[model samples]
Target: MDQGFFLLFATVSVITALMLVVARNPVHSALALMACFLQISAIFVLLEAPLLAVIQIFVYVGAIMVLFLFVIMMIDMREAVLQRFLPGGNLPALVLLVVLGVEMIVLVFWSDSFSVATPATAGGGDTIRTLGTTLFADYLLPFEAASVILLVALVGAIVLARKEPG
Candidate 1:
């Protein structure tokens, strides 16, 4: 990977991520998230993982962004956006974010090879096949569990939508 291109994508990714967090409108946030995902996909491409790059674009940018947009459109967030934030309403969330930030900082600074990229191996030619084999052979249970969990969430969403708001 060219250092200049890597730096460009990494900078754009971080900027877009920050934009996603700072954007007031949910739709704008989703768009910023999509930009961040695209930049990360470019980074994946630089790493010679075309399959992951494509999946990032198709799954995260395309499908997940659409889902976010749909949820944003369906919900009434006008009042939520207009309301003033109370001091302690978000304390738990702020504390959780601080904890996550500390953990990420520790992981990045503590690891000796944090800045080094793994050497490319020979058998990465057939990425899709390799991904499928690894998914089914090594990670089958986790994969199935994720699918089941998503299914349950979808069903729950449908049921909630159909229920009366008594």
Candidate 2:
């Protein structure tokens, strides 16, 4: 049952992620990204990380997606959409994708790290407490720095989206 659920979520996640990349419309792309995030959160739940799953939904699907939609709405995309996609323009991307696919296949098949299967351990009662402590105590500076960076980006987006009065 668990394996079936995992496969279902994993398949949906992959499909949504592909949709996110392939969608031409910015709003549609953002919606696909949100769906991908939601699918990822479901996978996290299957992995027994409920906190991570909730955080994934709250942070990625909620806050980050809202920020993305705001930026998308602020931008004028009609000109971009009107531009035709040249077939030759995709050559570079296709080459990179094929190279990456080959690399991933080689890594998966030849890597010693994945040869051994490790037993899954049950989470302790203090799992969340330990995670919180570690994040706050050791990673607080980096976390705060990331937040500040995101805030700056949001402000920058707003400024760029603002039009000068004639």
Candidate 3:
């Protein structure tokens, strides 16, 4: 990848990720995350890693983002979550956040060092064929489980929307 393109992606993606976490509104945060994902996809393109880029967009942006939006829309955002009632319990949350911050800092600096030279398994071609084959063959059980979970979620959501007896 060209240094300029990498730099551009790094700057934009990092900035948008920061904005994603810092945004007060959940919708804005999701949009920022989408921008971050797209910039990362562009970086993958620059590196000739079209498979990763496609997966990033398809899984993260397409499936995961839609899930997030569905969750956001399903929840009653108007309900106030009292600070005292929140699960974090304040002090522990602060400590966890600090630890996470340190871990992210270490990862951001050293991640490039972890790249390995794995020999390509398939001929240079569109990766969808191999991905689909693996998804349908070896990982079929987990895929079916995921489908069941999604089905349950859909049913539960409908149940939650029904009026209860007084």
- Against the reference, the lDDT scores of all candidates come to 0.78, 0.81, 0.76
- What ordering of candidates by lDDT runs from best to worst? 2, 1, 3
Task: List the candidates' TM-scores in order.
Answer: 0.69, 0.69, 0.54
Model 2's alpha-carbon lDDT is 0.81
* Candidate with more favorable, higher TM-score: 2 or 3: 2
In the range 64-128, model 3's lDDT, one tens digit per residue, is 78876776576555652332255556678558767976897788668874354333456657566
RMSD each, Å: 3.7, 4.0, 5.2
Model 3 residue 78 CA deviation in Å: 0.7
lDDT agreement of model 3 with the native: 0.76
Q: Give lDDT tens digits, candidate 1, residues 82-165.
A: 876677766787687679767876886798875676746447467677778888999999999989987786676565445357
Local error of candidate 3 at residue 112 (angstroms):
10
- TM-score (C-alpha) between model 1 and the true structure: 0.69
Off by over 4 Å in 2: 82-89, 105-123, 133-156, 164-166
- Angstrom error at residue 65, model 3: 0.3
Better of 1 and 2 by lDDT: 2
lDDT of 3 at 45: 78
How big is the positional error of residue 120 in model 3, measured in Å on the Cα after superposition?
10
